[model samples]
Target: MKQYEYKFSFLPEAINDCEKVSDLETTCEVKGKYPCPCCCYNTFPVPKEDAIAYICPVCFWENDVFTSSDDEPSDENRGMTLNEGRRNYKILGACSQDMLIHVREPKSDEFPK
Candidate 1:
């Protein structure tokens, strides 16, 4: 318990400031010579057609969807295009906020390795 240096928790304010961010909302097709997040190869195909995510063949970094054709690509949306944004995906938009990853200090007497 003492070994733990810090813990992070979601702030209520974050809800007001938090924007939708999710892989389902941000994955985009990387056509042509574009670097793959995994192998940095420019020829990676769209990994998940349904999810629109990118998986590098060389490095094989699957589930690394983070590309958008829109002018604004951000972490919240995992880099999705404007048309395919959260607003476009109702189910995803609802769960997208869960990705915010709020944390809390250990309340139990457990040491982390």
Candidate 2:
């Protein structure tokens, strides 16, 4: 699993050497913002390293630090794997069928180009 520090800063100077993404596919380097693993939307406030869990507002997948692999089931996520969450998001518009009511559609600016 990858580790990331949570930071909150709008100033460009706040970005430092620690905020570097080695893999765009699975990590976010930007300060105070992180890509939701389930939705791929840059909306998470806390990075994967910070234990304060965040559920994506768009897809409703709870951020769990350990389950970075798409195939691995996460206890923190109610035993749902990243792949299952992604598939559920496509079909139900949320990370799980039951989460449809808990999630909202991504804003126009939230989708990755």
Candidate 3:
């Protein structure tokens, strides 16, 4: 059985460090002002060290944006403090065995006719 490893990032900076790929193998790219996953729409690479929270690009428009309190700007007029909302967005990824094996007996030569 072959095992595969998975890696994820939510920022452009982190994806930039990865070896440039042909947009085929799980990789990253820039789309407009946001970072996009080269392989899938639900996945994008983000800088693990970045302070700002990351949201999935595919769902960003539909979902409320999230930001960490530490990264939020200090302001008084802002209806709700940056810290008021959720700090981090959920990110999902997985890795597992990529191969399967099966055993079976050969078909019999007997004919129905």
Candidate 4:
């Protein structure tokens, strides 16, 4: 497993008089860009690999490599199916209705080459 690290910071005024540091870890295998199932945009990391909760910025679809079929319900995606997400992306500009606020329009560079 790969040991990923992350760092976080808090505003000095938000935490009163305290200082803290975190050594977060993970086994994420993010790599080169690939097509996102929901948006068909080449902005996803790790082609066909376990997505490890990477959310697509363009479509807000939670990546789940286990979701192989368009109609398959994805447990990692709040019981939403890929087809449902794709339909939502087409009409609402996001994978799900609620995700509209979290998603952004795909940039020209994000499209498949």
Q: Which candidate wins on TM-score?
A: 4
Residues 36-61, candidate 2: write the lDDT tens digits: 88888877766656735777888888
- Top lDDT hit: 4
Tens-place lDDT per residue, model 1, 1-113, is: 36766556664434366677997688553452444332234544342333344433333233323444444554544554434433432334221344324212222222222
Worst 10 residues of 4 by lDDT: 23-32
State TM-scores per candidate. Answer: 0.23, 0.64, 0.17, 0.67
Ranking by lDDT: 4, 2, 1, 3
- Per-residue lDDT tens digits for candidate 4, residues 50-108, read 55777888888887778778799998789999899999989989988888787767777
Query: By the TM-score metric, which is better: model 1 or model 2?
Result: 2
Return model 4's CA RMSD, one decimal: 12.7
- In model 3, the worst 10-residue window by lDDT is 94-103
Task: Quote the positional error of residue 8 for candidate 1 in Å.
Answer: 59
> C-alpha displacement of 28 in model 1, angstroms?
19
- Tens digits of per-residue lDDT, candidate 3, 1-113, equal 99999655765553456676675576443332323211123233343223143433332311113434433542321333323222212121211011112111112221111
lDDT against the true structure, per candidate, is 0.38, 0.76, 0.28, 0.77
How good is model 1 by TM-score?
A: 0.23
